[model samples]
Target: MESWLEKRWARPLYLAFVFCLALGLLQAIKLYLRRQRLLRELRHFPAPPTHWFYGHQKLLQDGKMEKLEEFVEKYPCAFPCWVGPFQAFFYVYDPDYAKTFLSRTDPKSKFLYKFLMPCLGKGLVSLDGPEWFQHRHLVTPAFSFNTLKSYVDVMTQSVNIMLGKWEEICGTRDTGVEVFEHISLMTLDILLKCAFSQETNCQINSNHDTYVKAMFDSSKITFYHLYSFLHHHDIIFKFSPEGHRLQEISEVLQQYAEKVIRDRKKSLKDIKNQDNAQKKNYPDFLDILLSAQAENCDSFSDTDLQSEVNTFILAGHDTTAGGISWLLYHLALNPEHQEKCRDEIRSILGDGSSITWDQLSEMSYTTMCIKESLRLAPPIQSISRELSKPITFPDGHSLPAGITVVLSIWGLHHNPAIWEEPKVFDPLRFSLENSDQRHSYSFLPFSAGPRDCIGQHFAMVELKVAIALILLHFKVTPDPTRPLIFLPQVILKPQNGVHLYLKKLSK
Candidate 1:
């Protein structure tokens, strides 16, 4: 009786194990077939030798950009880069190919961008089709020339605060200061003042501000999530430690945005007149978003408002910080160009005490240097889009619908086919004569076409103001010991911080 009972239990357990093994094997076979199909479809585009299982994963480990550049050199216009056995994207660096893809209305890649939804929600960065168009229209006025002009004084004040901190640091630190950390805080300060009209004193206290800490931490975590395949699924990531931390950060950010919105709404109610409120004070980015909601109650939900606010806070501050940091790095590396920029700024503003909107345009040489820096170290290294329909490139190579394509801005900027001695820092490359001769899509630091950065104007203005003020107050020189190793995260960041020695200039 005991033996019979044992056999009965063992037979059922064995059968269940076999069933599960078969199911798993079937799933594996299905994925393998899908990989084979993708390989066949992308056979036309030549790619570097990739392992059957690992694909190009090993090659991209330590120095991703260096490996990418090697591939860029080998391939004429575009090439296929596989992330895994079942995934690949066409990395297009050529101007003509870039134009072909950017000009289209392809939706952003869902697989890549969906991870951002938890933090960003359905903000402009992730929206598509009619919803995207509507949001873009509503937000465009917030960045108008007149609106941006009003923020110059606020920007100057923010820059002054940062400069004051640097002045304090220069007195004690002879070893050189890491500018990226300081600049990141300054940009965040500026964004808060300009976006919500709240002064967080992030640049001064730095460590005491929870919101600022959350914002920076959130950016790092978001970048991690983008690359971590194991944490890609929503259910799995939500339960993980990193995911829990991200949730905490998101809550802090959202609560802050909500509070700002509530306060602003209450103030608007007291005014009782939208136009009068606008006439009294320049409407901030948040005000513009609120006004849009007032005009169309059906659209721009509360969630949408908060999402846009969070998006601006994240995208605005971080990207600008990276751009400014790299610009300083380039200027430090090339003193001649730096001096030229200083001379031009000195001629415009004697002490660089203040910068007006009109004066920003007058810094022509400085603008060229800024453009050159952007070309070399674009804040956004690459942007991907999922093709809504079959599309053919200028080279006659085509990708079918549903395929993802990555427009490599870094590759384009550094492509030897586009620019001569692309690695060398040459501001004259952006001169009017040379710029006119280049392809329209060849140099796209802000990206090109319909889906370009909405805050490009705002960013340029802030960059000019900060660079001018800093250059006036001190002479910047690169720290030779801390060489920059480019780490392409969500924003292009230096693996080692951007350290520069500052010598205070005589007033």
Candidate 2:
């Protein structure tokens, strides 16, 4: 009786083991087929030297910017790079290759942008297909020419407040002042007042004790998580210390954004408030999101509203701050160009403190310098896109579907073949005659094609207003002894804060 029972149980156990083995075999076959297809597509492309385990990821982690620069220079066109087992890229620097990629219906790389998903959510940057188009359409009106022109006053107010502090403190300091510190705060203040319709002065919190601190802390932690080996795994990242702090900081940002949305909701309900707000002629960013919600409740929610606000705040401010700081730096290094820009501003404004929309449009020389600065040090240096479908280039070369492509903004701007003497800080390259000579894809600090930055016009207006005011008031010169290093962070930032000697111009 005991032997018969043992045989009955053993029969069931044997069948279970065999079933598990068959499932494993099937999974192996699927992986092999997928990997084989990818390899076939990538077979002809050349890549930089890669490690067996580290691949090219170590270069990012070890802070090897020079090595990466050398590789890009050597292969100043389409070159392959491996991040890991599945993370491969044809990092393209050639303008033609870039145009081909940009022209297609490529999606943002999910693996590269994984870290940002926690804070930015599925805002315009992450959204795809009909959802992306819908959100983009809703927000487009807020950035119309007439609407952005009105925000110049707000930006001027913020810049004046920053300049007041700079003249009092930084102008008196022996070694000039840290430009990035002051400008970053001012940009945040502008973003809150103009974009969110929140009138708080983030610059007043100079010590960065409030939401400004949260922004910096969270960005740093998220960038760290992006490059970390262990944290690449979501499960592992969740249990890590950096992950914990990111969660805490993200909550602070989201809660702050939610507060703004709630306040705006209350204001919209009041009849008297609506009349006064209508004087601005156009709705702010918050209003657009809320209106989208009313049209189709399922399309945009309170969560989406808060997420986009946070995304804009983070994306808009940090990037512009870096761009403006770099602009001052380059102009300072080239005093002749600085004086010319200042002279142009003076010619247009003629002792006027505030800049009109018409006057802002007429500052051609100043705009050229700004474009040149952006080319040399684009705030967002590199961006990635993944192919949703196969593409055949003009050269008859093809890239199969499901590959990530890196658009190296810095590389294209500095390519010798594309730009003559790429690193010589020449603003004349942006002159109308010279600019028209280059390929459309050559200077893409704001990127190109369908998904180009929507806030670019607004950004240009703000930059012109702020720089025009700064030049009208002060002369900026780079400190010879204190050189700055531009690091590739969430935005390109100087390793040591940008220190420039701000000499108040004689009236």
Candidate 3:
């Protein structure tokens, strides 16, 4: 009887051991597949020597723009970057290399994007394979040229609202306003109205907006987790404090998006009750998604709808906010370019408060200034991809399938060989004559590929409208007291708020 009792306990313990052994073997196989697929043939390819065990972990952890610049200067095109012993990533800055890689049907980096998964949940930004293709195809028409044109009035109204608030705030005080604090909220408010046809009045309450705080908090955490070796493991990360915080913030963000989806879905059902005639006539992005879902269930589900919309809400707000904030700073720094852009806007609008769809086309100088700013401080400084097939580049270099590829849009834009005095805020470089002389892939602010930003047209239009209105009413000048420091966030943004002095202009 004693023997039987002892044997019973041993049986359960043996089962547990077996289970663990199986799991461990499975994980080992996965790691082997990942490493073997990304062959170390490219390990000997040009790169700074590693620390043997940690590889380039220390260098990457303390990584800055200087590191990126040095590498680009030395290699000029493509070079390997080892994040750790396991990670063998390749960095490509050459336009030709960029063009070639972009042309391929490579997927987004699986390892790096895991951080975004809890928040984004397989959204357009993180999606890959056939799923990504279908989602991109569905959303492409939502940002069509005609659709973007239709949004002009909504964009105008959103900008006008922001400017009106700015007028009151800047009326008596000579003290300049922080550009990011104002611009980010304005963009969020505009995104809601444009995407789901919901005016969130985000600017009014943005200071206390939990969603905004959560998003920015999550973004910083993501950057931190990017370099942390332990955070890469899902099992360990989930038990950590950062992971707990990510979960809490993700719930807040997801709930907020759920509310947006629910409200819009209900409003569409009772379309006749919508009091605003203008808003009633046009179908917003949500409406299009809903229509598609009803027609074909397989194409888009409720989960997919929420993910895509939330992706846009997060992406559409912050990236544009960062881009515009930097754009304003650049314009403020270069008063000459600011005046030229203002002159172009005035010639087109001519004291008219409304920025018509047709007038936007005439503001060529303004567009140039915007493009130059994007080049100087591209919101998304770099993008990473993973190859599905082995490929050879035009430069006689080849990399195996499944390796991580970092496309340094920031590096390419700032490359001295590709650009003349790249640091200078010279909008003239983007002039039709000059721009044509430059390589196609040299200036990839929107990225260049089948997977390029879907809302590129929308973002450009929104930027033009905002800049036109802001410049028309106030001349932006850099705050003499506060200097800005750029940091590589989820998007490239100034470390602190962007401070700019705005002198209201008389018509």
lDDT of 1: 0.87
For residues 362-412, write the lDDT of model 3, one tens digit per residue: 888899999999998899888998889987888788887767898988889
* Model 1 spans with C-alpha error above 4 angstroms: 1-19, 58-63, 172-175, 271-280
Each prediction's Cα lDDT score? 0.87, 0.81, 0.82
Best by TM-score: 1
Decoy 2 TM-score against native? 0.90
* TM-score of each model, paired residue for residue: 0.95, 0.90, 0.89
How far residue 194's Cα lies from its native spot in candidate 2, in Å, is 0.9
Q: Number of clashes in every candidate structure?
A: 0, 0, 0
Better of 1 and 3 by lDDT: 1
- Off by more than 4 A, model 3: 1-39, 49-63, 272-281
RMSD of 1: 2.3
Q: How much is 463 displaced in model 2, in angstroms?
A: 1.0
Q: Which candidate has the top score in lDDT?
A: 1
